[model samples]
Target: MNAEGTSTAGATPATVTTIAGSDSGGGAGIQADLHAFAAHGVHGTSVVTALTAQNTRGVTKAEPAGTAMVAAQLDAVLADFDVRAVKTGMLADLDTLALVAEQARKGRLPNLVVDPVMVTTSGDSLFEGDPKQYLHAFADSPTVITPNVIEAQQLSGTVIRDLADARHAAETIARSGPRAVLVKGGHLGPRSTSDLLYVDGRAFTFAAEHVDTANTHGTGCTLAAAIAANLALGLDLVQAIDHAKRYLTRALKAAAGQRLGSGPGPVLHSVPVHSAPEFATDA
Candidate 1:
């Protein structure tokens, strides 16, 4: 049982575990995940993989945590926590990725959501070396990978310039091992955003009009966390992702004028409309 008085044996209120870096800017990474988890009313725990000096402008410097430290953190959390879902983001190096994959392989994790964060919105590279090899190891771990357009291009070895290209890349990346793929179209040109979900040989497209705003930091982290939160709440992958998107849309709209940092700034993770107790009362 947990502090919330919920049992870990059966499906009830989902408890999500986030493995990612720390954002000093409080816009992305573990910060965003925790905020999203709270908004979705899921119990959230985290193991920090790295610490970053970043803001809305861009990531100034990132210091990767020792692999042993990363492993120890995971051990500490899993040793005593009943984590129903796990989401990973911003692993600075290959060793950390391998460690996380190893834990998953050993069945220490569940409902994994892999957000391959390679490049920042400012075009800064987050990984130091070839991450493809390490990322490929996650293909067979029964995880759901959410990669943006640029990440898909890098992972699939193809240029994704349009919707068709995005679909092709999603299919190709899906072949690598993830049970599902969600290719985000935020980088696509103009109009509306179209995020494609590929599962079991079928493609589902979720589209929304672009909300023109500069304070879009941590969008990926929030979306992946939201999905993980929903999974923790007993929703399937499709339902979880759909609810995540809707929640993100509202968050973006609510964060329109609020300025938090000198750079791009962070979105309002707590949107009033979606804060209804009934929707997220579990936590």
Candidate 2:
């Protein structure tokens, strides 16, 4: 403990996998995700589903990898590594989504955290199909799905205006397949940042101070990856989300002071972490 007497600790480092598009910008996508896993003291592996030639400014070009190549990459990593968790981002099309779903169904993707990446945090539209249709494929497993407000709207076909709406939207998406649904409220109006976590039959509201900054480039991916990191550390559902949000708050605050990009910058995940929050366990 530094200023305070409270001591905190991070979990032992373990391998985790990120199945996502390669972001040249290094702010969002796979690059950001790897950084997040390291920040959580977790080793990270990857399976590239797509590659984008873009920067903080915007996406100049994007090309998704073939389903066969994506599958091969997944196979190699899952077979070789003792991956504790797997999180997905930017499965650019139905084919990509279906491939990952196939892996999940085959029990190849463990502790799966699916980030239904339809739109980018930088206002890029990647997928056009209904998210619910794609999600139905994973309904058999108890996966965890994280979607921002707009994404939640796309996946749930429900308007998210307030906490109640967020809850309803999360529940609807949870019904699609995921065991837990986290509807991120980063797109909402200025106020306390909130997320609705709907699992099984209980819903918990997670709220935080909205850091007014443009450095929120990979907030969604980072949060999901962080949660997976916590899960790899063996924290239960509630505890993982709670710890992940706490990490995000500090990261956003730390990144607010950076000037990495002329446009929106990235959260500083490599920075030294301070006191940790108490996490719930599966006692």
Candidate 3:
């Protein structure tokens, strides 16, 4: 293990890019993505999709970058960096989503982990377009799409009340063109959290004891970004997701006792998780 407690043996030093928005609170969006990449020992790059005036309390205002500016950032990053994996968050609207989707289709965004960030943790919608168009535009591009229960319901038209519902939702969403879909169940249960991964017509369940804390802002972005980082580190899709899940669990646990803001804060990304507890243990 390296100094950060992340395994480095046989791991290539690679770059992972996040095409997402900026969170002034430094909790979610590109901030969370970069933190996850650094935690996994991968160099991080970013193409800002939007700018948001948000804090742990909630998002107050958001404005997407112009399509031209988004394109320029993508061009600059893809031109200069051999980014091994890409994770997307908070595309903001259909126009922004379409632009990123074009790059994914062209294979510029590799090992893509799409976190369908439609709303904030505080229940504010960030997307500003037709929901159907937003869903359709994502088809046939991402390697895996990670959606929380709310977003999964939007994508699959299913009400998820349990792991079974989540499984069905994952399968339904997988049919829409992503190679895999993870329906996150963080909001499903009171005592435990489960995530259903549907891939290759099969479903895998990852469950963990719920850490009781309000410091869960940006978890979705963090998990997706960690998946991209693990992929950039050369882990396969399932391995990457598994490792990412473990990493996020650890971060949540570490953040349980601390307070970062006036409202729900973020996971403790700066803490070293290698030996503090352990890495890649069952979640």
lDDT per residue for candidate 3 within 1-283, as digits (tens), equals 3543355767666888999999999999999999988887788999999999999999999999988999999999999989989999999988898899988888888899999888876889888875555458778888899999888888888899987888888888877778788888887866657788888877777766678988999999999998888787776777777777778888999999988989999998865534232222221
Candidate 2: how many backbone clashes?
1
Model 1 spans with C-alpha error above 4 angstroms: 1-13, 272-283
Off by over 4 Å in 3: 1-12, 273-283
Q: Model 2, 152-242: lDDT tens per residue?
A: 8988888989878988888888776678888888887766487778888688877777788888788888899888877776777777787
Q: Residue 43 lDDT in model 2?
A: 82
What's the lDDT for all of these models? Answer: 0.80, 0.79, 0.83
What is the C-alpha lDDT profile of model 1 across 183-234, one tens digit per residue? 8888887554778888888787776657787788999999999888877777
How do the predictions measure up, each by TM-score?
Answer: 0.90, 0.91, 0.92
Question: Model 2, stretches more than 4 Å misplaced?
Answer: 1-12, 273-283
In model 2, what lDDT does residue 136 have? 81
The clash tally of candidate 3 reads: 0
By lDDT, the candidates rank as: 3, 1, 2
- Which ranking of candidates, highest TM-score first? 3, 2, 1
